[model samples]
Target chain A: MELLEEKIRKEGQVKGEGILKVDSFLNHQLDVALFEEMGKAFAKRFAGEGVNKILTIESSGIAIATSTARYFDYCPVVFGKKYVSLNLDQEIYSSDVYSYTKQQAYKIMVSKKYLDKDDRILIIDDFLANGKAVEALIDMVNQAGATLVGVGIAIEKGFQDGGALLREQGIALESLAIVDAMSEEEGVIFRAQSEKK
Target chain B: MELLEEKIRKEGQVKGEGILKVDSFLNHQLDVALFEEMGKAFAKRFAGEGVNKILTIESSGIAIATSTARYFDYCPVVFGKKYVSLNLDQEIYSSDVYSYTKQQAYKIMVSKKYLDKDDRILIIDDFLANGKAVEALIDMVNQAGATLVGVGIAIEKGFQDGGALLREQGIALESLAIVDAMSEEEGVIFRAQSEKK
Candidate 1:
């Protein structure tokens, strides 16, 4: 987590409206080495969770989920597709998610064939802001009757209530770096270290 | 490649409209071990190409590209975003692509900061039907003045013209398994071994 925080401080850019951009290494252009390290940290945190599958929403989440899946006994990673594709199964557990970033409500789906009641799923994603995306994933898990073991994120907007709300719900959420505050004038600020109950 | 071919022959479903669904292991629900095998095969086929980066489109391509990047001297993996986010840089290389599967036209963009003229990029993707996705990626590479070393695909529809056109242009294209022809009735049939040029 220290390395991720350092990387963010070194390469992350703070834009208007408090968005921290780490595209140089985190999302657009990826550093596999850094992702592997993050994967190790995730494995360490959820070592005894009995996670059988890793679930993520498409685009940015796929790489991190795949990397983390390697450490979790090479668990199969199932990504929720934002758009309907010819290859996707028709029978699916679908949910609606409003993207504050995109300014639209889109559908996220997973084939009913992949997830089941017996599976322990770990949800992973790039950013946890308003938590709409993570909540959508959790909703899909619930519909499938699968148990959500935990949620893993690369960066969490601690200033927002998304992470806090999840922890209050007794959901195990582990974010590698949590940004409590950020501003063009004031710079970025991460939350103080505290173990989540 | 044998492992991949075997996986397809086993779990791959033959659906109507000439579609072969292997989402259980390839794209939607990803098998990390299988992706590792694919990465190794790609490294073998594209050996000596001086590939410094793995270039791919977002969502489906991210997982395979990230896995393949590890086999290429830990080169950085860059994914084109289907939708621009607030976190994206202003400067970008953009290309329009028509998706036959989704039946829509969309723009894919890569930050100008990630790719350079001197970089040798290897394009990785899950499937190649009409080759529109790979062509769009090649266009992005060209726009950035980067050299496209080759393309590595999990499955190529040999019946389609995409693979043929690329090879005709003297581009090195390697598909783990090329389906020469397939039918809902007769199932999937890969191209003859002699056709593997």
Candidate 2:
């Protein structure tokens, strides 16, 4: 988490009041080494949860989920597709999510063949803001009758309520770096990670 | 490559005439161990290319790109964004891609900051069919003045001209599994891997 926080402090750009742009390393352009470190941290946090699968949304979440899968005994990573392609099976568990950043509503789906009651799933993603995407994934997991062991995120916008809401629901949500506040003038402020554990 | 071919032969579903669905391992539900093996194989194939970056499109390609980056000294993995967001920088190298399966055309954008003349990029993708997406990626590489060492594809539809066209252009194209022919009735028939080399 220190390494992530340090990287964010060094390269992260704050745009306006709420947006923290980390495309240089975390989202658009990726640092796989840092992802591996984050993966190890997630594995350590959720050590004995019997996580057999990793669930994530398409686009940004795939890389983080794939990285985290290696640490969980190479658990299978299933990504929820935003666009319903011809290749995707019709038999899928679908949920609606509204992206605050993109300002649009989209359906996220996972083929029913991938998830079931016997699987223990861990959700992973790059960023957590309003938590709509994570909520959609959790909904799919519930629909499949699968148990969600935990949620692992690379960065959490703590100023937003997504992370807090999950913690209130007694879900084990672990974010590597939590930004409590941000501003163009004051830069980005992070919540002490020590407060979580 | 044998391991991947075996996985496809076992879990891959041949739908109708051309569609071979390997979502069980490659696309939707990803097997990280297999991906690591694939990463190693790609590393062996592009051993001395001095690839400093792994370029891919979002959603499906990100996982393989991340997995492959580790072997290339953990080079930066940059994914082209199909859907542009407000957060993405305005200056981008964009290209149009026609998706044969999806029956649509979309723009793939890469931030100008990530790629440049000095970088050696290897494009990684889940499937290579008509090669529109790969062609779009190659265009972006050319736009950025970057060196495209090669393209690494998990599965190439040999029945299609994408793989053949790239080879015809004298591009270093390596596909892990090449399906020469496939049918729902007769199943999938793969071209001999030995014939390529």
Candidate 3:
């Protein structure tokens, strides 16, 4: 977490309207070494929760989920594809996600073949803002009759409602770096993990 | 390679027309252990190429790219973003790719900050069919003035023109499993690497 916070302090750019750009290392351009560290941290936090699978959304979440999968005994990582392809199976568990950034609503789907009642699923993603995407993934898990183990996120926008809502629900959510506040003129302000709860 | 071939032969579903769905282990639901094997195979094939960076597209390609980066001494993995967001920087190298499966054309863009002329990049992807996506990625590399050390593909549809075209262009293209022919009735037939050229 220290390494991630340091990296964010060093490279993260704050745009107007509470946007933090970490494309240089986290999102668009990825640092797998850092991701491995994050993965280890997640593994340590959720050590014995019976996590048999890691679930994530398409695009940004795939890399982080894949990195985290190795620490969980190489459990299978099932990502919800955003785009509907001709080859996608007809039988799928899907939920709608509204992206605040893109200002659009899209469906995230996972093939029913991947998840079931016997599986214990851990949801992972790169960023957590409004928590819509994570909520959708949790819905998919619920629809499959699977147990929701926990949620792991690389960075959480604490100023947003998502993190607070999940905590209120008593979800075991671990965010490596939590940005409590940000602005183009003022830079990012992070919340101490101890102080967050 | 044997493990990958075995996986394809066992779990890969050949649909009608030219579709082979391996979502059980490859794309949608990922097996990191298998990906580690794939990363090792790719490292073995592209050894001594001085690959400092792994380039790929978002969604499916990010996992393989992240896995491959570790084998290359934790090289940075930069993935091209398909959907444009307000946060995306204006300065980027963009290319148009026509997806045969989706039946649509989309733009793939890489931030100009990540790639440079001195970087040695190895392009990694999940599948190579018509080669339009890879070709667009190659074009982005060319735009960056970076050196493409090689291209590593998990599966290549040999029946398609993509694999043949990359080979014809004298590109160092290594596909772990090349399906020469496939159908719902006939199943999948892979081309022996020795017989491919």
Candidate 4:
């Protein structure tokens, strides 16, 4: 977690209106070595939860979830598909999510065959902003009658209610780096260290 | 490679119109253990190429590329962004790709900062049917003046022209499992084992 926070502080770009860009090593361009460290950290936090599956949204969250899966006994990572193509099956558990970035609502779905009642799911994602995406994943998990062990995130926008709300609901959410505040002129302000060793 | 071929034969669903759905392991519900095997196989095939970077597209390709990067000494994995949102940088190298699945055209972009002329990139992706997506990635690499060491595909439809075209151009293309044919009734038939040890 310290390594992630350090990398974020060093390379993260603080933009106007709470945009912290760590695309260099987080999202667009990924640092797999760093991801492995994050994986180990998550594994320690969520040890002995019987997490057999990792659920994530497509595009950004797949790599982080994939890396983290290795730490959880190589759990099968099921990413929710945003864009529906010709190949997607008809029997799916779908949820609607509003994207603040895209300024529109889109549907995220997982094939019913993948998410089973026996799955102990760990929802993972890159960024947890307003928690819409994470909520959508949880909704699908409920639809499939699966038990969500917890959620793991690489970066969480702590100023937002997403992380707070999940914690209030007694969900064990572990974020590698939580940005409490950020400004273009100033810089990213991470939340006080709360990650358990 | 045999492991992957065996997985396809077991779990892969043969859909209508050349669709071999291996979502159980390869794309949707990712088997990270199997992916580790793929990583080692890719490392063996593309060894000594000085591949400092792994380039891929978003969603499906991100996990495979992430798994493959560890084999390449934990190289940076840069995934091309298909959908542009509020935060994408203006400084980018973009290319047009027509998706046969969606039956539409979309632009895939990569931030100019991540890719460089000194990079020796190996394009990693889930499937290679028509190879339009791979071609788009190659175009972006060319635009950045980067060196494309080769391509590593998880499943290449040998019946399609994509794999053939890349090899015809003298590209060192290594497909873990190439499906030569498939049918809803007869199941999947992988191409003659052509993968190097």
True contacts kept of each: 0.95, 0.99, 0.98, 0.99
Better of 1 and 3 by DockQ: 3
Question: What lDDT would each prediction earn against the true structure?
Answer: 0.90, 0.92, 0.92, 0.90
Candidate 3 residue lDDT tens string, A9-59: 999999888789999888899999999999999999999989999999888
Best by lDDT: 2
Model 2: residues >4 Å from true position, as ranges? Answer: none
What is the model-wide C-alpha lDDT for candidate 1? Answer: 0.90
Kindly list the per-residue Cα lDDT of model 4 for residues B1-197, writing each as its tens digit: 79999998889999898888888888888999998899899999889989999999987899999998998889999999997867889999999999987899999999999899999999999999999999999999999999999999999998899998999898999999988888999988777774421
Model 4, stretches more than 4 Å misplaced?
A: A194-197, B194-197
Rank order by DockQ, top first? 2, 3, 4, 1
Model 2, A39-86: lDDT tens digits are 999999999989999999888888888888889999899999998889
Q: For residues B108-185, what per-residue lDDT tens digits would candidate 3 score against the true structure?
A: 999899989999989999999999999999999999999998899999999899988998999999899999888887
Report the candidate with higher DockQ, 2 versus 3. 2
Better of 3 and 4 by TM-score: 3
TM-score of each prediction: 0.97, 0.98, 0.98, 0.97
Docking class of 3: high
- Minimum summed lDDT over a 10-residue window in model 3 chain A is located at A188-197
Best by DockQ: 2
